[model samples]
Target: MIHPILDDNAADALVALLAVREAGGVPLVGDSRWSTQYWSAVSSHAKAECVGGDKAWASFSSGSSGAPRVILRSASSWQVSFAAVTDLLALTADDVVYVPAPLASSLTLFSVAHSRSVGASILLPSRPSSSAEHLTRATVVHTTPQSLRAIVEVIEGGAPHSMRVALVGGDHLDHALRRRCAALGIRVIGYYGAAELSFVAVDDDGLGLRPFPGVQTRIVGGELWARSAYLASGYLEDGGGPFRVDGEGWGTVGDRAENDASGRLMLRGRIDGAILTSSATVIPDEVEAALRSIDGIDDAAVFGLPNERTGALVAALVQFSPGSSRPSTARLREQAAARLPLTHIPRRWFWTEDMPRTSTGKAARSQIRLCALEKKARRLD
Candidate 1:
């Protein structure tokens, strides 16, 4: 089977995907938005053996943890969950599912597959629009939090929202965003998942995520491990980084989480995304969450900046809404100090008009750090 190089063309990509699936060929999909380094990783996975005797989909990791790599997902891995996705979204032939992310991305790719399996019409990625007319027949919207944020504002203060279900993924759904979506009558459900692990847990009630049905999750060494039918095949150039499968067939993606008393999974952050300072190991997501909680700040990214003393310094890059007055760094440090340990409080601060994010809305940490460092990010102390 000839593998197709999918790019910005959705119709061509869809046709190519259909051809590959019909021919039982695992189409290797790479995001055109990715750096050449990302493509190199996908090239490495082209050598991996297609484990099952069925059609499969080869995708690259989101690199939110660290460096991106290729992952081979069997057709059954998605096909087995088709009905679940359909039922979860309450999709029908009359329903039109809208996903504006690129077809190359796993979120949009799986969404494209899900809509087709359920016989639902799809609105593929195109010129960005917030017009209510475009969302007229949109019953279900599968998108990232970044994209959804842009969309909800378009629904007006009390618009007759046509969208019913909002299937969000690719990043953590903030608390305020969840409430805002609910206020608009859009039931937003976010899934915590990875390319290597299709669907691990889902948060529907704005509390926390629970292991998906038929998915068994356990906290191992402060990291989340799972055994599910939808798990992906082994990586091609897996240097044994975070992709590990125990002898019992449980695989973890290096995500750290704690289990609450009621057994709901509380995500701390990724084990790979932590910053080791002189006094404490700071999780950027935790600090970023705190930053987002602050007034006037719209989005934030926290990363470790190289420092001669602490080996690394906690740095924050922030984005605020237009017309909002910028908060002083001293004020920020004071606010963060109340909620975080001294070590967790940012030692430096940078501001960007918008966050550095990938096509799927996940933070591009490396790019973000580069952007801030280029600006000579201000130091707090």
Candidate 2:
């Protein structure tokens, strides 16, 4: 019988504990103001399920990737991942780790696990905006790229914070954001993973690349496949998805990837959203990233359009930076081409005050694509 932890004290923590318990190990639940009452409920459930040799289980809220599915992770899996992160960051017991993301997030839980494994002190921000304040006394800061952007904005606005190591994840880190962090004398380490899997790759340096250890990655037919000890066994309900391994035991997340001659992995985009053009394939993420780097563009979403000749043509919908003047279409197209190949250059552009975003703060590419296509159809009509 699967006992789901309802205690709110970092629901993800409860999920992790559940996984540990299922693996026949004892797990500890920590008290947090956000989910104190919830933790008590889960603690009671754990007691009811207690058997002589049964393991303790923890539950945590996995953000937005899948439906609310609880992951059953072994205690060894947590320990191994924590140890790997500690070694990657050179974290010590004396270091002060600051976590700005919600405790329920896998990223924050990983930080907490790393701290517990090393006897380090962890400081969680009371609110998202208070992260800069917490960073003042923090040696190591773990946060999402979005939160890190906010923190850097605060710092640039005269907030006082000294950071030794900055771990950036949750979303892809753009080149523009990385350069801003570098200017602050802060070393940014980019790691890639999802709630379904632990961190599979991390880049400790500023080389714009991610590498993996204790993990095996291969690109099959342009899709990136991986096998690692950190991956969860399977989803709770569906019990099947991309996590399924082949005979070789490698699993894929359906992300298309390209590797440089130096063997560094560069994510092209999700295969689900790939646009096929007559001349080549178009990955929306690559084009969107390029447009976002252009001056005066605040955000961008690139998608495909039906074309008589090209099968599909690229289009971009963008939000301009606040108070920045918009560039001419020709100028914007030229700028995009300078950073991308001709095929990658967006053939159409639509300017908007803002683009819709998911609750997790990622651009709603599907919605934006629909809007762009509708606008084009209306014009033709």
Name the candidate that leads on TM-score: 1
The global Cα lDDT (0 to 1) of model 1 is: 0.78
Per-prediction TM-score: 0.90, 0.73
The lDDT for every candidate, in the order shown, is 0.78, 0.67
lDDT of 1 at 292: 84
Q: Residue by residue across 158-276, what tens digits does model 2's lDDT show?
A: 87887777887766787667788888877788877655566767777766556467787878899887787776554433454444567776776677888888788888777867788
TM-score of 1: 0.90
After superposing candidate 1, which stretches have Cα over 4 Å from the reference?
Answer: 1-4, 35-55, 127-131, 157-161, 238-241, 373-381
lDDT of 1 at 210: 95
User: lDDT per residue, candidate 1, 23-115, as tens digits?
Assistant: 777776666666777566555646444445654787667766466666667778887877777767778988888887777678877887888
